[model samples]
Target: MLFALGFYTLQALHYYSPYFSIFAVIAYGLGISVSADFVCERLKSTRASFMGRNLLTAIGAVAAIVVMVFTIKDTPPTASNANLAGLAQYMRTSTDVPGDFYDYAKKPSYSVMCSWADACKLQYLSQRAMVSSANQEIGIKGIIASERFYQATSEDEALAMLRSLDVKYVVAGGRLTVWHGDISKIGISGANPDKTVRVLKGDELPANKVGQLMAARMVWSSARLASSGVTSPLHHFRLLYISYYDSEKPPLLLYEIVKGARVVVKAKPNSPVAISTNISFNTRRFTAWHDSGTTNEHGVFSTIVPSSSSLVFQLNR
Candidate 1:
């Protein structure tokens, strides 16, 4: 009675309470073993009893199998560790991540984006990003740097801030809890750039957290590059282009298009020079381009491509 009924009780209790799975499994093993021993001793001397023992054991095993099969079927093949490994493989190998799968360390450069007010993660990102090049380490940095980061508090204020910073990149993913509306105006600037810029837009309404960071990184990297003279034969002079933001980054859509463009680039010590390029969905190709026009000698090249290709620069120099 205890064997059958007790097992049922544990199963029912543990099904809804995942925390108890290990304990329940242990209890079931112990209880079943004890019950088997008691039954064997109770009928020790009878030949017929041996047959009964076999029957009972078979029944118990079958019952356990039923429970296990149901549980195993409901649980994924890669439940925890295995599931995460599969996800990591997909993130690294797949060109586009599937919706069902997610990278455990989503933002390699940031630990994990937190609530805007989470000061701890913000500080950690800024201070610890260079500690390691590993994804987990980058995540630590991302979380800390973005801890105090908020989707623009206001369109006017954001625009003003961008203007003040002479900001080259601005990510526009809005917070559902805070800036729960369209952010079209937040990235717009009245000042014309001397060089060229690109914007990428996504088809998915309401971009995900990954999209937000990808956009921010593209812009951030672009802002850091300086102009160069030698260009890749692959890229020359071109106009605005289009590409799919299919990575764990922003989603971009563009109507106008160009590819294989090149631009001048310079970077700080130990940084690679970049050449602005565009991923053209229309052509199904990523092309380099050169930034024309002129700079004020500080090498700040700025020109507008399109708002849809939010990130328009690439490294080449």
Candidate 2:
């Protein structure tokens, strides 16, 4: 099992392989027992000597156990790890029922797109389905779809991908800023069509990792893509909840795929209609986003815009 992935590559993962580690522990244990036995053979066959030998053997066993325990890394390795409890609770009680989803699924459920699909604690706690996960569990197509969705640079393209995947929710944040080292940034050669590496500009992350980084950056930028030079809060996706998380390990942010309210505007024939709106949800971190569309021959233009429950409720006013 150890040789299957090659001796050098097994160290790539932070989590140790149980099979390999167990074998290693057993081999070391046998060696320790043999050493203890050999040393005991040289001792006198008296009661005191027997007692001393037994004591030495017990000490060796305890030392071996201590070494194994001390070498083991803690799961997730940090207290600052993102908390999925709040997001899980919301997914369980609140999300859209089974009706807004596909026909095959009859039970009340929703699919979520997560950053680390392999760590399925969120799904297990919430009892929800995932759009895709690591290791091609949902198939290679699902992984491809997920990668395309994450790497998308445009909101329109991202929305289309989400809609196609039938993902109603998104799980972003939690090590989204991870630098995948040299292996991740190795882009396929544009000229050769072969697996070739390209020289990327300084601090330029790979295409696959850009969206994850952007998601984390967006949260810090007050739910807006300021770094992208955009003033819009993600129009189609609304932030439903931000789980309890640490500074270094950001919280898992839950977003609902929303169909913004359709608003029609009237203008002169062949005139351009400038559209803009102000929005805020978690806090009064208000931001305005703008868009423009040309009016049709009827001097009318229709567009979808984000609306909040607070806007309709009198208490928030």
Candidate 3:
């Protein structure tokens, strides 16, 4: 009765879809119900009916599977590098893709992506909740096929999938970062020592690799001025590098922030260097935060924010 349940759910929400989710739910429910009928028939000495029920269940299961597979496979490609900047901004405020997307922050509850009848139970949860997925496969498995998650045979395919899904953020290692050139690693981990590119979501891809290299080179030049990882205990002078996929200009000199405990920085005498803070945070909902600005010639800035989890930026004196 999954179909009926979904229909009732949609009705409760005042949804107007043709009840596709309801139908699927019903089909699957029928499969199970028919199997139960078969068992009951066997108990009542109804041999012919048991066979028919078994066949019905089998058919229903196959139909459900086929419909779900087709629906997932036929989803349209969603990426367009052409207004990439604007789309990235929009996605920054969004938590998940359109199909699996949900928001219970309002009344008259509504269905988001995938199922179109009722709000997902997940919508009621707060954004601070975190779901850890150790690997791509696990993460993909957690999401419906129509969602942003997918299994690709190759890195190119995976990148293509991200583009198709208009994925705004990606978490990967240095090797994949170098390969895709679109995504960057964020924060620091013992597993990721180089601390190359961390968060790659920005307005536009640099015009060319030279621009990217320039950005990397600039970061390397100013590494001594960047901030340390949010988790770092013993702070020291750190150089930061943020990488990206579309190579057009330098990846970006996000800003040089200080790292060591109780450390302070001011631009050296006669140095006209400018700097700004790059703020970021992580919870279950939003992936990363990036806001870049410049500092006065003296290059002085500080904040008393929490050191344990807060990502900070301070330029070296």
The candidate that wins on lDDT is 2
> What is the RMSD of candidate 3?
17.0
Instruction: Estimate, for each residue in 1-317, the C-alpha lDDT of model 2 and write its tens digit.
Output: 53323222322222235356545554555555666666666665566457645776676566556545643532322222336655665666767654532344474344677755423565555556676544322323423454445444567877777776677887775343111221222244211243333334653466554544334334544354542335434666666666654645455677777776666777786787766666553324445555566788978776555554312211100
lDDT of each: 0.33, 0.52, 0.32
Model 1 off-target regions past 4 Å?
Answer: 1-23, 29-57, 66-110, 114-148, 153-175, 178-317
Give the total clashing residue pairs for model 1. Answer: 49
lDDT of 1 by residue, 1-317 (tens): 76566655655444444457546655565556457757767866576456546765666666565655454332322222332223222222322222221333443222222223222332222221211123322222233222113333222433343333222222222121111222221222210232222222442224333323222322212212312323211121121222233334322221111222223343333442333444342345543433444343554443433224345553322
lDDT over C-alpha atoms for residue 291 of model 3: 18
Candidate 3 lDDT over residue span 1-317, tens digit each: 75555434433332223355556555665766576676667777677666667775676666556545534432222223222222232332433433332333432111111110111221222111111211111123334322221112222444444444433233211111211111232312211245343333452233332222222222322232233322111122122223343334323211112332332345554444332333333222211211122344556533332123335455565
In candidate 2, position 131 carries an lDDT of 60
Ranking of models by TM-score? 2, 3, 1
CA lDDT, candidate 2, residue 205: 60
Model 2, backbone clash pairs (residues 3+ apart or across chains), number: 0
Kindly report the root-mean-square deviation of model 1 from the true structure over all alpha carbons.
15.9
